[model samples]
Target: MPAVLSPTYREVCLWQEQVPREPLPADPLPHEVDVLVVGAGYCGLSAGASAATAGATTLVLDKEPLGWGASSRNGGMVIPELKAGPEKLAKKYGQLGRDLYAEVDAAFDHTEALVKEIDCDYVRSGQLYLAHTPSHTPHLRDFAGELQRSGQDVQFLDAAQVRERIGSTAFDSAIFFPKVGGLHPAKFHDGLAKRALAAGAIVHDRTAVTGLRRQAGGFEVQTTRGPVRAAQVIIGTNAQMDAAVPELAKRILPINSYIIATEPLTADQLQLIGPQMMVDTKNLLFYWRLTPDGRMVFGGRNQLDPVDVPTAREFLYDNMVRIHPQLTGVAVEYAWTGYVAMTLDRLPHVGTVDGAWYATGCNGTGVSLNTWLGDRLGKVVTGQEPPPAFAELKHPAIPLKPLSSSYLPMVGRYFALQDRR
Candidate 1:
């Protein structure tokens, strides 16, 4: 479960980029607890914090130090629902689907509230989905209809209108959703972990959950440090859960997502880009926005790989220029990449396995979805009846192949080539 092979994120511009990281000690874990949660990212930490506050003896474990996974390196866009459009979700779940969206919207609200209460740097500036080509415009307009039907405040724009609002002629059209926003992901992750520790949750970092056994009344988990027995278990590992639970791993593909940060620009330069967060429509998508520190944080993914600095810089720089040619002259201050879990359906899998509980496969929607799942999983662990929406959810297994690891490069290259169209 160590993200030793996981992707890295840029170290400049982000609020928590080079902040002092808490060390995960080599101490042994105690033998028993009321709850044992795997993975110390947002979902695990949030779940642990809630459980501990409810007076449950909770313990959280991670294979590497905190902030070592997607939780820390993600784009921090807290989009308040699944990747599926409203029309699709409605067709799929009927009235139940609408109710589910409401639940997720509440999840996003809880995240903002928690950030404020914890004194984390959070914002509600909103997010825009930009369109670069004529063919892309229709999709954005259709998306606006679906978003409006979902009870979201969405505005569609033409090329001139978008250019006026964003100060860039790069987009042919765009969709703005006030409900979606951005944040400092790493800070939020660390803040949640700190609050969990303060509330009496025992968090073990650099600790890997090596084995699992079904006990008579509960489950016993083995870690690198020692063993832990608990009445309930939660898995918040996402795509990184492969070695820990192979069955769940096959259902989710871990893809490398890259991000780049520019040096702080002058107020005049920032004015050229305007203030909102924006992403474009392409099979291989890219998102670019101004950080609170006045630097541009741009990101997107076309494939999965073990990304390094050189490859990340080249890939991101080339793609960024296609959207905003003026940025061709801008210097890249930093570049990094991280792996995210993607499901075939592009929806998160939240359900129980045996007596073990789990919340994984957020696709690219992990920021808000993970927090929501964490809150829901916390309720489930405390024996409260889970919401009706989660009852019918199931994890569709991922097809495994002998050449799976080697499969990334080929799939990625194909998409990269196709994205240029």
Candidate 2:
């Protein structure tokens, strides 16, 4: 008999298999709310929870099932990382740059608190960042010292040490982040949803926001169910913001990230690759880790802009074998794809656009950054505090916005070529 095919994200995600996402029951669409949050991913739910706790009547609307986006589809690696390091950031924004880094550190702290509260299978398994080539080794070592000076418990690992940690000689040197860890994304999302509901925020799944117009009092948000008047609005849609607010969408480029899980590995295979979050330094990088159940979950970029799932699976599988040839013939048990928001400046942006406040452009670090910024935005919406330091940073505009899609594939191919060298 022909073998049955494995389930892809079109059916169910491996991480989400444990915490099933059933559609939310239909609910009354209130005519008015103190705050309306569009998108029910990590950012929206977090914002809604904070706003409701601040005594606002908050409503969170999503076009699909809860955690249906990148929030649940990510690799679950929690790194309090920004694209620009402290030095470059200071050079760019002065004292505000220091505050930006501090904010990310606080985000990490928030995740640590949530991991215990959520009871997700979170392991404080350390993280390792590898240098892809010898030429790139020294820069990473220096960066480790920079982070150490800034009070992070980061250490530079030599070639022998890296092999000892990961059991692979594919890398020359590496940096170890002891505080970095991994968790079940879907479980965390489930816990967050419960938190939002307990805090009195109403979450309406499958309710798409069609239009957002600033009115005299505040804003008239048109959803598929009906129009709701909102005293304040927060856009947390990230990659899907185009459908809700077109002008705001122009600020971000949606890039597709794909992942595949190999069947459970043997004890010997597991020993060859220690179970920690592993990422290599390349323009087009790869990250992989062993799931709690022993499957090797590997993820990376697609070769093109528009995702072809079959092609993504093949590409990732071949690359995984290239990195660790032990599992060349292992069957892939799962596959999935999610869109990551990339800003021109390679950093997240938080502030207003089209009169509605927003926090987006996670740049592949959404697991921690999104939740923290969303909480801050929620508080700001209810007058709890001022705009976050990120608000002071510029949201770089894309050149030739209408033609970005046409040029994305070209740029992706360029990055792929650079990865080869």
Candidate 3:
């Protein structure tokens, strides 16, 4: 961490207006409810709002405050494709693959509309997915051709074109997606929470769920506060998954990703970085973009396990400088970590596991997908609609089981090595 004083290394959200603060107050814990949604992040709260609107007595509970999870910590890039592109998904699931991609596309539109409804500094700015190595550029170039033939709003940019857009030679080439957008994640989370509350759902913060079991006629949720009975439950927790539901824990691996925000850049510096959200093709990839106030927020997951924020900040700063040497020694105003939920399939899953509904596995690009899936879950639980196609697919459990964390660092090291090659 740069020794330069910038409010004393507290883990500030940077997107929030206030500094570290208390969790918002909530209604009294309900002894019984029609729909119980765990986790108050984007997906959970969205489900709460929808369930409540559908006339289900809903309650959303969280272990931490409303805006204290990856939902707020994420870069707020609303890219609507799954980890696999439409073409790849089409190859995998045929017509259902195309339909799943359409669902994600609808998610992007829903997110845009919701952002507008909430007035959260939404920008319809396109995104640049850069090729991190020379070997990757040719693949992206060919992939861009595939996307174009399928009528995607995409373009292939050679190294020269990429430099014109990014002012960085760190990447070899890029694929542009004009439909991507950016927003204030914290605002969106808080706004969605408020919407949930206004819809007559109760949101309780700082309430940790210890266990959940289906009982006669409903499920009993054991929490740090007390057990609450619900006719239906949605295990909407993403990266914060714990042993509350062993089935979810078996499938979701929580990995830490760090982010650092530099002091507001100069006009000249912004010119160098360009005004678009960006990500790279590396296994341990990098994502960056300019905040509305011109601060550059750079994020990556070079290391998956826990590390002190200071160490992560320095590593990211070194990488940031390597990517844009112009930012060398720039004051890092904030550094924080958020967990990304990963599964063996590298895709988000929505299904009824262990007799409870769940939508986990964002794979690091879930701002839009989570909200959409959560909303779909709300409707599904309320008998308004069926589960999305993703639920019908098989959800694979990670190999190595409970001992996976012991060898996870080795996997991280291998990914870093692959990024180098």
Candidate 4:
């Protein structure tokens, strides 16, 4: 097995330090509920909240503590777009593609509303998509044009303007989306979980679902604690899937992504990078932003192999210094990793099979997409409305499932090479 980080290292995620830990219930989970949702991340918790609000007896289960997965470990960027470019989507799916983009735009609106309702430390300072190579500039321009044509707010920045905004000469150009923003992910998760509980959802942590099978009225879900029977089950486990849901495992690939956070910087040091969520245009991308406490939280897809805190700190720090040589000897105080699920189409999917509902494959846009999809899934399960267009789209299983473990690393390598070019 790959070396696992010690408990101290695992606590390195800066988000975990921002909120007080909520205690789980000692009372045994009821014999059953109207709905049993798996995974306690944003999706599961949001789904639980929605279901309970609609008067369903909802219970959320997670293998680890609440908000312990990518929900809290991510870079806290609330971007409203997908990995697939708008032009490509337009060419392939036409009006449907455009509609999907609109849905993503609305997701940002939904997120903004939630941030306000929850009163978390959210900033609408916007996002910068920097071009890592000169050749990538035209693509950024095209993307900006597509956004403008679709009636979205955007601005294109030249190399000099990019340097002025982010204080980085590494990028050739950039595209700015005024509506994109950042937040304290763990705090947001905590607020959402509290809302779910307040809405009458029981959340059980350290309860991993071991087996799931169809029963007479609903489904029988076996967990570490015991068996749970529900009229419906919603699998919100994005990239952290194991054997609990074999069907979902075959449809998504779980790739490791890492991040490193530097010690809180001086106000002068913070001036080197302005306060905006920033990401570079690369197949294997690099994204960074300033934490609310003024730390530079930098992250990327450096490698597919499992990494410990020390190794990740070194790798990400070296890359950070390359982007901003002024930070050459900066201290990296934290390091952590999260699993991001990638689908064959690089888009999120929501649907049902064998009387169970699921929403997964966020492809790195989980902060916004997952939360939105979770609410939609709740409505679907409650018979409130139909699934959205993206959910109705086919979610095909990945090819050659047996070799994915060996093949994904090679795929990562190919993307890394492309990023260099």
Top model number, TM-score: 3
**Candidate 4 C-alpha lDDT tens digits along 8-116:** 4443677886676967876798898999999989899989999999999999999997778999989889998888767778898888787778778777788888998
lDDT computed for candidate 4: 0.84
What global local distance difference test value does model 2 have? 0.86
Q: Which stretches of candidate 1 lie over 4 Å from their true place?
A: 1-16, 24-27, 305-307, 406-410, 413-421
CA shift at 114, candidate 4, in angstroms? 1.0
Q: TM-score of predicted model 4? A: 0.95
In candidate 1, position 190 carries an lDDT of: 80
Candidate 2: misplaced stretches above 4 Å? Answer: 1-12, 302-304
Better of 2 and 4 by lDDT: 2
Which residue pairs show backbone clashes in model 1? Answer: 8-337, 251-398
- TM-score, one value per model: 0.92, 0.95, 0.96, 0.95
Candidate 3, RMSD to the unseen true structure? 1.8
Per-residue lDDT of model 2, residues 345-388, tens digit only? 98889989777999999988889889888888999999998998
Each candidate: what lDDT?
0.77, 0.86, 0.86, 0.84
Lowest lDDT block of 10, candidate 1:
1-10
Off by over 4 Å in 3: 1-9, 17-23
Task: Pick the winner on TM-score between candidates 2 and 3.
Answer: 3
| True lDDT of residue 167, candidate 3 | 83
- In model 2, the number of clashes is 0
